[model samples]
Target chain A: MKSEVNTVNNNISSLAQAKPLASPAVQIDFLNSDDLIKFETKLESSALYPLVSSDIDIFQVNLGKMCNQVCKHCHVDAGPDRKEIMTKETMQLCLDALDSCNISTVDLTGGAPEMNPNFRWFIEELSQRGKHIIVRCNLTIILANNKYHDLPDFFAKHKVEVVSSLPHFSAKRTDSQRGKGVFEKSIEALQMLNAIGYGKADSELRLNLVYNPSGAFLPDDQKGLENEFKRRLKNNFDIDFNELFAITNLPISRFLEYLVDTEKYEDYMQELIDAYNPEAAKGVMCRNTISIGWDGFLYDCDFNQMLDLKVNTASQHIRDFNAEDLHSREIIVNQHCFGCTAGSGSSCGGTTT
Target chain B: MDNSYYDPKDLKKFGNITEWQPKLGEKFFDYYGEVFKEGALTAREKSLIALAVSHAVHCPYCIDAYTSDSLKKGADEEQMMEAIHVAAAIKSGAVLVHGVQMMNKADDITM
Candidate 1:
């Protein structure tokens, strides 16, 4: 099985870059073209229209778009070919913004945030500020090269909450969605994290794993899946993690391409519509978390950041950093927003309801 | 509406039987939901049983729903295939066991 990364060597751009889908306007148009009820109307019926932030508690920053693998369902369409990376100046701007706000958590995400040159510096700066740091570490990166081999040790030292994606406990299922050999590497990376008290019972180092469906389906009950994951990982490989976050794959970027190509787009949208839960809608992560793009522009959530939907406020950039304006601004929504509100609801922290 | 006897789309309407026969439909659905919950048998185990039963009954909709249900419940390929084989074994055994009846009839009719 060839790694999906090989596509980069063949000179393939991300789905966004290769087609008219690169334009946010086109994606938004495609989402709205569906005959299903509008997302805002559903919110209105639930009395959640004009959804405004409760408060900004988590500041999620995209470090870059360079990754070791090209996952089939990646909403970012991120890969090795992506050259958009946040510079040190942008990192400084983020730090400055954090200073002005009482936001307690900083979430670092990317194609692979560790791929950024300033990633360590940014983490160090955040650590020094006593902010709760969460790194969305793709486990394979810890073993991708010699330089990254020490990542587990570095993460332990900083007490950075290490949340990694391992789609399934089975190798075939996991690799099918992520890549050919991701499961094995992830297991090895997890063992390394476990060896240094990362996910241990007595350790303060928090390690969590993220699980999404391997195909066009919603994930099973998070608690049940976590139990299954714990049993299988412990019996099969002796790995341990604190919690499992079951996330619904929002239709955007490469995943949107997959849905369109496989002709499951309409059916999937209908599934999401049928599973819509109003309780989940009210707790949608976008209401409490703000997403910052690689270059410092802000959005309602990471999915919005990928689709280029800037936050609806005067302080649309990190440099502006107005908590009051952000708190009162209406969140941007379209058909894709349904993914987050479906069933138990999905957020970076797992089910919102 | 089309020529085919089955439409995958109909699976989504499984809940709508209540519109016409509300009381019985509601009762049946409540029973069905209760039957599949975690009991002495884990939901995962029940899902595998459902997959096997789907095959024995030859219900395409059940086959489709239970297969996804089994996977979602974390039943792997080997476990799923083994469950179907359980159904197959019982189905074949039912046919083979009737050979005793055929033998008895032959013995009674023979000279």
Candidate 2:
């Protein structure tokens, strides 16, 4: 397999493979593809139905795929060239659904959720409804534009929970995965966030840092890694944050290409398989979350959303959302689900165990 | 027969040592496990020390194992590299300090 680094010349052409197929008829195969199906069957033998949604507590919206930076492990293959941005109509649909469903959290994600032109309007609506809003910020977005400089203050004003991905506290590891000068900008963004009492004690403005492994390895214990991050960030830069979330990299999009390019796909898959925990599987995020694409299409979770695997229901769009049917829908699982069940387990918020 | 001195394949078979000699291999494994267990220092600290020593001895296998071990134990790349530098500095000093012995022998023989 060839590396897509050179081919991705800041355009949509780069995402020829990374883009999710329009229809479910296309079969996506990774290294040892059969293992995913067999693993699901193995769970059934143990009387465990691991892939089923219990309730819909989170309404995760992918604002679009227009990001400033093109990360190597980005599952969405989001970059500047991608033109898909959620419009005002879709935002209204999301707001209506949230109002009717009484969802607890409205997770806003994107190439950069803030990149969307209607980001402020969408958040204002969500906040007006008294819904807890979580922005899956990419850190660099805070410093990407001059207009975005006031976002930390904006977030604090709205009492929004910010979950930013900071792969590692160290500049070398972080820049290698993100981009050159990214660590500096991210640190600056973090400092700006801290100044507004985001991560400060007794402050309602909650700030969380996310840690994804730079390579094809599982993250360390969340509590231990959080302590280490807090110590290092504080001792080195006088920066403080709330908590660290360790998310396992699912095999999809550019990460899948990377696994194939490095020839570690089979080994990595086996590692996830051998480390499967039923306890972890029980608490998989898909059980309580519904992911909405930029176009208002619905998915079981973020990974399934990336894979273009729509929910296994006739009402596959948020415009047609029925809480009763969606809550009881069987989660559409595949080999990628193993990434969530391995070892300590992983989710958008943090570790399951 | 495989002619290479170090079969890249054998590294993957480290856990299969008991297949050759079950009794002594098991004993050695037990002792190795005990040596790595936490006492005063943490398993993380021990892994860092192991990573430093692995570089000093120039054993690729040990270096690979300890690098992964150290990362898994929550040691960052910065600390791991620092440990390696410590090993490198000490190894170089050991070689340089031995020049005193060489000088003493030369003086005794020549004088």
Who wins the TM-score comparison? 1
Q: Residue A85 deviation, candidate 1, in Å?
A: 0.5
lDDT of 1 by residue, B28-104 (tens): 99999999999898898999999999999999999999999988777778889999999999999999999999999
Q: Taking the tens digit of each residue's C-alpha lDDT, what string does model 2 give over B1-111?
A: 687677666777897988899999999989999988877876778889999999999888888888877776568888999999999999999999999999999999995
Per-residue lDDT of model 2, residues A234-264, tens digit only: 9988889999999999877777767766777
TM values, all candidates: 0.93, 0.90
Model 1, A94-193: lDDT tens per residue?
A: 9998988899999999989999999999999999999999999999999999999999989988899999999889898888778889999999999999
Give the TM-score, chain B only, in order for the candidates. Answer: 0.97, 0.85
Estimate every model's Cα lDDT from 0 to 1: 0.89, 0.83
Where is model 1 more than 4 Å wrong at Cα?
Answer: A1-17, B97-111
TM-score of chain A of 2: 0.93
Pairs in clash, predicted candidate 2? none
Steric collisions counted per model: 0, 0
